[model samples]
Target chain A: MADPLVIRGVSIDDTFAEAFPMRGARIILTAVNARWARIAAHTMTGFATSVIGCKCEAAIERELGPEDTPDGRPGVSVLFFTPDSASLQQRLIERVGQTILTCPTTACFDGLPDAPERMPVGKALRVFGDGYQSSKVFGGTRYWRIPVMEGEFLIQEDMGKVKGIGGGNFLILAETAEVALAAAEAAVEAMAGMPGVILPFPGGIVRSGSKVGAKRYKTMIASTNDAYAPTLRPITTSDLPDGVNSVQEIVLDGLDAPSISAAMRAGIDAACRLGVIRITAGNYGGKLGPHHFYLRQIMGQPTA
Target chain B: MTDRITITFDTLPSGGEGLELDGITPDRLLTLSNAEIAKLPVWMGRRSVPLGDIAAIQGELSAHLRFEGDLARAEGVGAGMASGVLDVTGSVGDGAGVAMRGGSLRIGGSAGMRLGAALPGASRGMLGGEIVVTGSVGAEAGAYARRGLIVVRGDVGDSAARGLIAGTLVVFGRVGADAGTGNKRGSIVVLGSTAVPPTYRFACVYRPTVLRVLFGYLRRAYSIPVADRFVAGRWKRYCGDISELGKGELLTWAEA
Candidate 1:
């Protein structure tokens, strides 16, 4: 058997987290004030928790100051992920047109200007102007101005898309449910506002960890992860330790590996508090994914 | 300072009509030796003269060039310029920067008539690049600008932006009469006083996001002075040249 590992008075599992390839885009939403920017961001990122159910995943990466935006307005930066480039473009046009363009005092701009792939979202949305839309170029970039009843809605003509990583995750095991929830919340707070990563979940914690497929239902693509379910410990080959009664899993999506690694290091460090039984990761034995993040190797490093 | 070609007028043209030096940009001059460059022909009235006979040429061959002394009699100073920097210390005669494709032309002094206007026969003017005149410009500035930018720090004479196809013309000082009379799909941003022609109809008073970017660029790139009121204030939009396409706009700064 392999030897065990411990860090800051907690056990560290040797397994790695496996992540798959995904397409990502970064968008900036600016409004007259921070409140409207946040509103547009939240509304656009809603109903987008997982690609399996929603065809995409998204969340607010951070709130930006006026200096960070092109128009000198309070802004918010959001990240989105999908399985491919075409799917990403569809989601961007649909969500931005329905949520951001309709929002008062809100304007959208491309966040990742250096990405190789560019999608023409603003040009597609310009039809809302009904032949009255106009475009102007500034500093070599084109921006579309659509006339609205309240005023004008300005958006960049293109959005930059880049290949990214999705399903980077870690699990927290604790002796009780209360302790596990508290540790997960602390870890989420530590990962908040990370520049290149987004936690596309409610409260940044997922209690319903899923597996690849169901045992009896052949049509189901995924089922409950019984191995980590504390109630299934005595009936199945459970991965939980003897004293563990609760588990909390955190999943992250990022523009690059370094960003996800940096976020994982901070989150794991914060989750290694009192009453925690062990820290581990979810994976498929390195068979399904090309990117593997080894827990022990990551924890030993000083920084990402 | 990779050797800038400096052209100084040690003596003026005998007739004061000056020589025409348009085809000889720094880029073109870099291909020739100093002796070959000095032998290049410059037209004065109906006759051609060697450049060495009229002006003193110094410095190594490079893309940056400077002109000193009075050039108000000189014609076609930067006509059809492709790329690189050309600076003029004194005034330039008519047809300055006509049909300019790309690069920058900065005039420290005023420019005569037909500045950046269309060629005598050709249709378009000031194809793609920037022209910054620190002082005033003569009539018909950017007459047929197709795609480019022109910033005038001082006042402009009559009929500015006439026959405009598409581009931007910004003036920080007063603009003379009959502006945007035949414009189509272009923009005239006036920060100073100007009589709005009767053909242009009032659109609205609003802040344009594109102007914020342009004004910022002017302030940084050319050090053009911009007041805070224009940056944070609203503008009265006017759609002009109803006889033409009527898509062109004349944006005037709205006062409080």
Candidate 2:
């Protein structure tokens, strides 16, 4: 009906999406202009590709308006998430203290105001000045002024922490690495800067998306998801159809269900193009994680 | 109830014990259960009593605490409070925030002399913290304050900051003469006008940048009402205590 919607003649699969709960915070980075803003944001989010080994997962949430920021300048909002408030607080302090505070024209604020658990991220970090630091309270929130070489650096006293969703994703099976990469890039480009969504993967593509556990390594918690691997088609119960020679996956983390759903919808629709095969999701038979997003349901159809 | 043990006197003490708060930091007491706070120690007239001996404890040891009843004879209400909100529902005796490091102490009524001032033999008063008195203060509201803030919403007596080391004091009502007689570094922001001492020399007529920082602190921390002029108007800066460090300043409001 729509050019048969085939990438290398591999049928375009239909399914919904899924996600899980996690804690999240937003870090805003600013500089003299967009260039510095991007630089700080990039460095802050660097090496934090996934929560699997990083202990915390993060990505750029969006670009903020000058009027929307504290210093009235261009800024980027980065969402970071962990399993708990304590670790979340620690991670925020470590990251912001190293990245945003050291960067010029930058200040940090609690992105989630509605969170019940208020953390003293700034209050604890104020001790860096030994005894010279001074504090000013504005609107009942205290801000610490630590003298730096350039001038005084002001940071909000507390940051808000809230629960969010993690591990929302979909897979794109293509006929070749070029098609897979191009499609993954397009899907990433489609979802880039989408509100409340973050693609926390290298170049927004993951070739090593894993299944729950390993068949060979007894101690391994996860191993390669070999179902969609083209090379394993002849040796294993391959999920890839004929002519679907390669695949790449896009993983998303977001503030909530609707955000993941929105990003998934945008990404899947964009991937349904030339040289694209079927689209599917990764899950453990619906036994784990509370959230479930069926591909067909996300494609505006009833789940089978 | 609050984790902090507050004692309200059933009977006022005749002799001044001069309560000391060197050991009490709000952080240590704020989150304890009631059973936990009953064990802390405080001095009675000449003897020591458990904190549970006087005031009835209520609420949890939250970041905020409110103590009611007359404390006119009670000294050291918020002495040594490091961090947390301490609200005295009535008048307090003296030596509040003596050598205080940080936190806030708000008194609903008058405060005795040496409130937020240094204890005897000590070089400085409150090292850091904010003491706000809603009613009149006896004398030396912020004397020898090294670094902190003291605000008197009411009238203050004479020799407010005698030998003040460095800090800030904002008096909304009348400030008695010889307010900043000290010869050191500090600032006195007087919203109410009074005769300046001859020892002080007029420095400049400019709005102080510190006012922006101080006003913001007042509005946010204590919920104090701030007038537009105070935040936007010019100030008359008098630099003196020249006999000492000569670093002190008295920033009076300049009339339009």
Candidate 3:
């Protein structure tokens, strides 16, 4: 019986964002300093935007303090997600070897130590030492030391994998492109560094949001979301209102449902400001994914 | 409440013919009553005798098994034990923890030869579990061990970690001659100074990140005295047993 809650001048949608299950693994990289740690992390996560083409999606989870790392050095934690554990393992070995191992004074450790499922990434990479690699067991976990040109590179024998949620997304409809960009920035700022979640897109905002299938091409898996396009509003079915002229999206991937919900709540709250016409979510009729984050419910409003 | 069962020697055997007390582990006794445990048979020399004939038994089954008095004639004390804690206040005979699968064995006094070593015909020794010795152990400690950990706070006799196939052996004191000989795969971390065998080829001196996790675990789990210098120091890695797989390593503490 309560009236719909409104923040600033923007209206909150009643739809929910559908999220699919993904296999994820967290890798912790430590370096001599924070600068090299970030360099390795950024290189490892590069080109890993979506599983559609990159075969995996990865992002820097957070910057870890020296005490947080195994070697007591500055470190960065990265979260990688794939459709399954096999693919997750494959991408982990390929990325960690090419980026982390190649970086100066960097060592890789498993971030998800408590996860039951494990993948032998370092075990596979140990061959790079060409029979020179040695392993050490500390506490109970095993780590492999590979002799690199720059001293030695140490990595955990196995990385832990767990089931995570991906493709939790929302769209921002605004009266102008500038307004939409500002709102997206504000939403990203609000949701930055939230635990168990990562905004995979660049700057945590996506401009080219896509629909499930192509309009004309049968082979195309996805096409531009023409319904939200201001230019195509006259030709196609426009989901936008009269004053809405621009739209951008924020896609989220998290370790669980609660994390996505918490992030969405904070992001939507920051986005529901002046010039933003409405806040809506992307979903496939709640049929594809098991997790659904209702916009209004997350904003503390009763669902219709 | 003290849930542990204490067993003290009531009548000490005269000879050193070795007693097979493999069944006296904590996990095996956890289900038995005091009388039932006392009736358990232990092989002495060529004959079997009731455990109560040699030791005074008290308390019911618990997570811990405490043994008092010198057990220097007790061989296979915790062999093949899968779980629980075995605390020995005195020295034990040879093959004390041979072929153990899991659990922890802590010895306060010296141990005889082949501590945590393989059984007579078994391919591997101490497949899983941990053995901690506060006093020096005799020859061939952790020989042919496939997996698990063995920590020696005192000097280790000759041929330590011989034919090791994937496991860890940490010697806080001096490692005797011929240590890590013919080891296929495993790690031998020596904190005290010792002569390296010619078979081991010096690889490099570097700090291993795994030791941080391991040292931290040892410091917290067993309250083992881990020097900050050794925990945070570089180690001289030597790949050895070239006559075998040459995959095993000997990491000697270099500096703080």
Each prediction's DockQ against the real complex: 0.41, 0.06, 0.38
Root-mean-square deviation of candidate 3: 3.3
The local distance difference test score of each candidate is: 0.87, 0.75, 0.88
Taking the tens digit of each residue's C-alpha lDDT, what string does model 3 give over B1-256?
Answer: 2479899965455765567787789989998889998999998888899998888988886879999986887887788888889999998888888888888998989898889999888788878889999899999899999888999999999999988988789999999999998899888999997888899999899887667667767777789879889877999988878888888889999988
Q: Clashes in each model (backbone N, CA, C under 3 Å)?
A: 0, 19, 2
TM-scores for all candidates? 0.88, 0.59, 0.88
* Native-referenced Cα lDDT, model 2: 0.75
**Per-residue lDDT tens digits of candidate 2, residues B83-196?**
887777788887776777778888989888788888789887878878888888878878888877889988888888877777778899898878888747677889887678
lDDT of 2 by residue, A194-297 (tens): 88889988877788888877899988877888888788888988888778888899998888888888888888888877788677888777778888877666
Per-residue accuracy of model 1 over B1-256 as CA lDDT, tens digit each? 3478888876574576566878767667766777777898989877898888878888656788788888887888888888777888888888888888877788888887767778998888888777889889889998988877888888989999999888778998999989888898788999998999998999999887667667766776778778878876799999877889888889999963
* Deviation of model 3 at B139, angstroms: 2.7
Query: Which consecutive 10 residues in model 3 chain B have the weakest lDDT in total?
Result: B9-18
- List ranges where model 3 is wrong by over 4 Å: A70-73, A134-142, A175-179, B1-20, B30-35, B43-47, B52-73, B89-93, B108-110, B120-124, B243-245
Name model 1 segments beyond 4 Å from true.
Answer: A1-5, A301-304, B1-15, B19-21, B24-78, B82-93, B103-109
The better-scoring model by TM-score among 2 and 3 is 3
Candidate 1 per-residue C-alpha lDDT over A198-270 given as tens digits, one digit per residue, 9 for 90 to 100: 9998888899888998998998888899999999999988999889999999999999999999899899999
Q: Which is superior by TM-score, 1 or 2?
A: 1
